[model samples]
Target chain A: MTGPDSSRIYTAALLIIGDEILSGRTQDANLAYLAKWLGVQGIRLKEVRVVSDDMAAIGDAVNALRTSYDYLFTTGGIGPTHDDITVDAIAAALGVPVIVHPDAQAILAGYYGDKLTDARLRMARTPQGASLIENPRTKAPGIRVGNIFIMAGVPAITQGMLAALDGVLPGGAPVLSRTIAAWTQESTVAATLGAVEKAHDGVQIGSYPFWRDGRTGANFVIRATDPAMLATVASALMAALQAIGIDPVDGEL
Target chain B: MTGPDSSRIYTAALLIIGDEILSGRTQDANLAYLAKWLGVQGIRLKEVRVVSDDMAAIGDAVNALRTSYDYLFTTGGIGPTHDDITVDAIAAALGVPVIVHPDAQAILAGYYGDKLTDARLRMARTPQGASLIENPRTKAPGIRVGNIFIMAGVPAITQGMLAALDGVLPGGAPVLSRTIAAWTQESTVAATLGAVEKAHDGVQIGSYPFWRDGRTGANFVIRATDPAMLATVASALMAALQAIGIDPVDGEL
Candidate 1:
């Protein structure tokens, strides 16, 4: 449990590797999923980097992020196609050679049976001395080298891999959040919100303005580790929003 | 005109500054919009970084990205709320003090008029010696310092700012793409696609796999600066798909 005097901070970084994302051909869905999942595990997602399939760019990003965070998760480029160069890129980044993991090969072989082709064999490759992250849905497993966890680009596969690794990582106290939405422009109640945040010592408030149903409003998300502090801040925020003549909704729009 | 020998690559990096995105409270719509918009202007969006509202993280990302790419575009954190710390962060990154730009102040004052409050005045602050990116829809303008373009986190405001900056930056030839979607697994025809890409000197192929209606398929996107080469690659890809007994769809599904 986190107290007022001491709190541990565990951070992670996500590196999304793909050319389709950069070209606007594919909308990325992995970052939000991974971030939310990490939050539940009591690890803060500190940063995210999206790089193309270029080997140099991938290598650079992996090297930069892996050392900086307690955990580094990467999505995409781990498929069987030609553009799937994440394993090679990560191998280069770690100054190691790409090798076929026996466990991964066994899993793929068992899944594909006699129909396993050379193209499918590509999925078994990983950086040397890496561990395999089990995929419940797909036979091809994700790779884990050092602090980096390499995952598939497909949202479903990424989710499955994340679920498999649940509770495996050491985490700190979980950060709790409560949202208060109001049908008023953020600028109109900005001063009041700022005062409420300043008055609260252990809470951080984030105001996200939105235009929904032809009306402008904002959602103030108050985050804190202490439940009592979060409750106090929530009440204070609700009062402030009401004092500004805007009815506060308990949740988001 | 882009020829085989003299094709120039103009690249950019986007810094998405917001905690909402990381917390999964907000789905980021800015990257795709900016990527597609930049493509029309013949600039490639190479990499993207999403950082929280923390000043150090924002400043570090800005400093790292601004010097590496031809241009750096940052969206989010430029609002009246307390979480909006992008301006101060950018100022710190550039080693300059945040000051109210006279022109920005004039615009905000004229827009807000008698209803202008201290919170609204915060929108006028920018780093010293930065130009303004006009936001026609909203009174508050975007900031531009050196090669960095700081725009609003809101999609509408960011779009307006990007539109106002149309044709302002120098660019190379636009990269054109033709997509051929086929109802077949990419791994089955990976070798043929790789061969076709190798035979074409100036063209590149990207395979994007999808699962639709409980069936697996992939889209082969052929990209090239030369129109002739792009057409040749697209035809070859279609023939290759047909050869593998898969019907090809002309465009994306």
Candidate 2:
């Protein structure tokens, strides 16, 4: 709840509400985007839960995450369809009545003009005393109630909603990262990588292995809140890999 | 836990452990593949939680999901690197000790031969009373402890582990799905879709909106365990879309 200058880390959790995702009918494109966007805001994405469109499931996850993280974001189930029950579910989770925000209804009315129907108006419903997150691409605005920000599932629309909230929430120092890749199996240099990470304070290194062009390799990502520490760790990792006769690339191979 | 023949739905939850995924540095490729694979086994992937590589995070998620679902599957953090603490974390969560499986050690020893290092042997570690989920491509096998199936982070390795697990778990009836796409805004047919779902029993429909080639459209997915009901709902949906003056395609456009 404090400002970005307070030097405390801010965290968030994402709840992806959709049966299509759970059914494997759709591959999620929102998690990576939200993670990167939150990182720029100086908030780390701590966790993510992908649940179905079931009301109780959404409500339970929303209640759990909204209490645990600094911010809780939900994507999907906010459209004008029968399956879009995000508003109703979140309201139930918050123990508040669902109300149609006057401004949201007005925006939908203006957007639809003479063709506005009851189903279309469903987009204006939100939890009591909620505000709107502007959807620049689509007329249906996203809802922001308590610590929860409900946005559309579509990547582009979620982007617009994120753009609307840019620099609005207070965040801590942005986490910085540097990558060093090598043309060797990760197991070959696991010990040195662990030792390097333990040698540095407030620095964490992640090893991601890949198989490309019939060869196995890995990329080491060093992260720290301070840029100087990140660079030092990255350099040390490169040296360590080179010591093992593995040529380390500056970035991903 | 009842078997698949008991006329009850079987469910599973997935726990994705990795810092790279939460840091926005890597996109998760395992969830969708696992979801589809579980579907074929007639086990529903009810929920998914993506947590960081921290021990406590992994342990807490494993405890939560393992109890809530019939089975819990975890991907990532099962490698030979320092960051790979999934075995230790899971062992702690289960209130058990981490032990090196002799069979896993023998397999790794046989595959790596003289090149086997301590780091490589770290892949043989698992929670107490755990069994191996064979990785046909890589010598490092997956770990299965109680209801938890610990797998590799790489897509290919995870596939091999799933293949080893084929027909091993008890599952309910396989969920079937039918998709209907129309080049019209979903709001136009929201009322009809909701009504049709209400009129049918044991059927659920999901509406996913999309914008392509500068045109608005949506795909309505109908899912049901019974093939007859699925077909009936699909026909009703197509007829409803036709009544609304929108031509619907049988599958996704």
Candidate 3:
């Protein structure tokens, strides 16, 4: 466990479903949260797709993302609307039957009591053999089969469920980061940024363009799996910005 | 002149490129904002994907979403950085080569005046036969080729470009929504929500779970294309929620 190359980066992909998402009625919040969280875990979110609610489209997408990445997470279309077809589509993608599990029904029943019915039970119907994700938001319970975790579309709900999944999921190296917003143009520190990049190929350096109150600036973010490497890169960044007479917000934050 | 058979729904797909988005360094703010905006425009954001800085991955994603959805929008990886490769990928997907567009170059040339260099000139690189979308965020412009609209990944920049594109985009109908949240459990409104769903088949009516500060509630969101229909469904929702002893937000906000 105490090896030199202890940082192992796991990979993930997201499959966003729902015609509402594709039709531009809804913006996705889960993609960013999932990507960021995974990154910090030394798990890379390699790809993401927003697709329609059509079963065939959803099926094809689920099949593709599931195969491509080590873990595949999906959001949207798990709602109680007529257009909520993610469950059927996912099951179809796996060529499995969409059936209600005792555990899932129990999860819903604990909240709904006797009010749970045929349509309400539809939420409990996941692909056979898939485990249920406890949806604290609705008690509808998302499903996970193989490497795929089907989650809610709502930002708060999806993120909450993902947080719960963290305990059970085995993650890669925990990713730590330090970002400094510099009051300098990117071009001014471009050479120094290039130097840091060339020196530490494993560490990723990104410069973001920012404008506030008619003033333009750049946010330099340095990320890596190694804590010491991050410190070295960050020191270089601060030195570069200072050398160019540009101040940067310092410290571990 | 309104026809009963007119299709009221529209759809869009999003592809996010850049190792940053994939690695979770940035939470994608565009997908949510774009979703809410498109919802107002009667378009649903159905599918979305995030890919690494890899050109092959980006190119494959571009071709896939572009072929499947009515419109495809991409954010990130269009910058002047070395990792910025969206343009090359777009060109590759379309079976074309990356070439510097004179019009785009003119925009950059005007922005920096005499400071433009070969590295900065990289921003001018665009796919053949593509129209450049006006970028209000940075000097580099986003390109639109066929159905796909390529834009920046930064929230403010992407949103600004989206606002500019809004003027010329062909929209089917504007989607209107009204939400009512109150202290009530989902079970308490399940029956009534079902009734609302049944009565307003043309509109989408669903209940979302909400919990804050030891208080629990449901957010009932009603969405539809027709103004008259939206009003009717909203009125019914008010009555239904109020009937369940859940107070309305003072005459439909």
Deviation in angstroms for A99 in model 1?
Answer: 0.9
Clashes of each: 0, 0, 31
- lDDT (10s digit) by residue, model 3, range B1-253: 1223337455677787776666655666777687776665556676677777787898888888889777888888776665667898899999987889999999999998898877678888888888888888676888898998998878888888888867366556766767766676555566677788788767776555556788876666777778898888878878887887878663322
lDDT for A33 (candidate 1): 89
Model 3 regions lying over 4 Å from their true place: A1-8, A17-29, A51-54, A76-84, A107-123, A134-140, A153-160, A235-253, B1-10, B36-44, B136-138, B178-184, B187-202, B212-216, B231-253
B173-221: candidate 1 lDDT, tens digit per residue: 8889998888877778788788888888878788888888989888888
For candidate 3, the lDDT comes to: 0.75
Q: What is the RMSD of candidate 3?
A: 4.3
True contacts kept of each: 0.77, 0.88, 0.43
Model 3: how far is A95 from its true place, Å?
1.8
Error of 2 at B109 (Å): 0.6
- The DockQ ranking, best first, is 2, 1, 3
The alpha-carbon deviation from the true structure for residue A12 of candidate 2, after best TM-score superposition, in angstroms, is: 0.5
TM-score of structure candidate 2? 0.97
Q: Tell me each candidate's RMSD, in Å, in order.
A: 2.7, 1.7, 4.3
Mind giving the per-residue lDDT tens digits that candidate 2 earns over B1-253?
1254936899999999998899888899999999999988889999999999999999899999999999999999989899999999999999999998999999999999999899999999999899999999887999989999999999899999999988889988889998999999989999989998999999998898989899999988899999999999999989988998989999998
Docking class of 1: medium
Which residue pairs come into collision in candidate 1? none
